[model samples]
Target: MGHLFSNYYEAVSVILFGIGFTTLLLNRNMIKKIMGFNIMDTAIYLFLAAKGYIFNRKVPIVTGEVPTPEQYINPIPAGLVLTGIVVSVSVTAVMLSLTIRLYRRYHTLDIDEITRLVKEEK
Candidate 1:
């Protein structure tokens, strides 16, 4: 019970990931799909960062005094997550721009409608 309470973030992240997957799988709106993708990306980032974290740890840096590995938290996972967030933002921006273009052309954000219109045009 205590461990479960302590690791609630993991549980929330899993729920978010599942919701995002469901949205991605079932949603018809392009914007909603993008939002779902963002949710999934965020959940993954949260889960990874949470996994990498340690209780009662300091930042990873060597001081004048000799430091043991256990004294500091590993920086790699945090760095990776930061990079992932940047990439996700860029991807989201590009996806939104594409969605905007699609909406302008078809006057609808529905993926099915867009496909059908494209099919009719071809």
Candidate 2:
């Protein structure tokens, strides 16, 4: 049962990664591109958090039980993922702001149309 649950989490993370990649490739809108990047980031964090869960294992830290290294999964990945999420959030904010600015300047969100307009002006 534990093994099945673990595999399911791993599978979901992999699927998330695949979806993010596909969205990034197929979408032309800047907002969609940023969303895809955020989706990939979320998948990475999910993978890390899943890795931190232990089956039938108590939390690490010596109280009365002898600490067994094998019983606990590393928590560093989870911490790193937290930091990654923060950074990704900041990046998304900046990207969206830029997208808004671009939209205001061009009055259209279509990438191909924007490019054409700029080329014609040049």
Candidate 3:
């Protein structure tokens, strides 16, 4: 649809989210799964940024005249995106560290294999 094309960022974000979700679901490699999750996070950030942007609008700071609400783009989405980035990075670091430990213990990164080995140990 024309509207879909006009809002290309949202469309692209949706497509990226689908790809990430599919990768997360279909891949068995731990690193690939993490990559997929990062992709999804990126898509969400892009979507939020796109939604926060407005044509012909200034940033929220007022320089000379008192600004009306309509004069500036909303700042909340940008703030949310920033917060999400911080959380995403923290989560990624934790995941990678855990994955490293798993690799060390199992000598493999395949989750199914690790599960099987754990069951065998039990």
- The clash numbers for all candidates, in the given order, read 0, 0, 0
Each prediction's TM-score against the native? 0.85, 0.78, 0.89
Tell me the deviation in Å of residue 120 in model 2.
1.6
Off by over 4 Å in 3: 62-66
Q: In lDDT terms, how accurate is model 1?
A: 0.92
The order by descending TM-score is 3, 1, 2
78-97: candidate 1 lDDT, tens digit per residue: 99999999999999999999
* 40 Cα displacement, candidate 1 (Å): 0.2
Clashing pairs in 1: none
- The list of candidate 1 runs beyond 4 A from truth reads 1-6, 61-66
Scored by CA lDDT, what does every candidate get?
0.92, 0.82, 0.93
lDDT of 2 at 29: 85
Task: Choose the strongest candidate by TM-score.
Answer: 3
Steric clash count of candidate 3: 0
- Candidate 3 per-residue C-alpha lDDT over 1-122 given as tens digits, one digit per residue, 9 for 90 to 100: 99999999999999999899888888889999889989999999999999999999998888989789999998999999999999999998998999999999999989889989999998
Give the winner by lDDT: 3
**Residue pairs whose backbone atoms clash in candidate 3:** none
**Candidate 1 TM-score over all chains jointly:** 0.85
Give the Cα-based TM-score of candidate 2 against the true structure.
Answer: 0.78
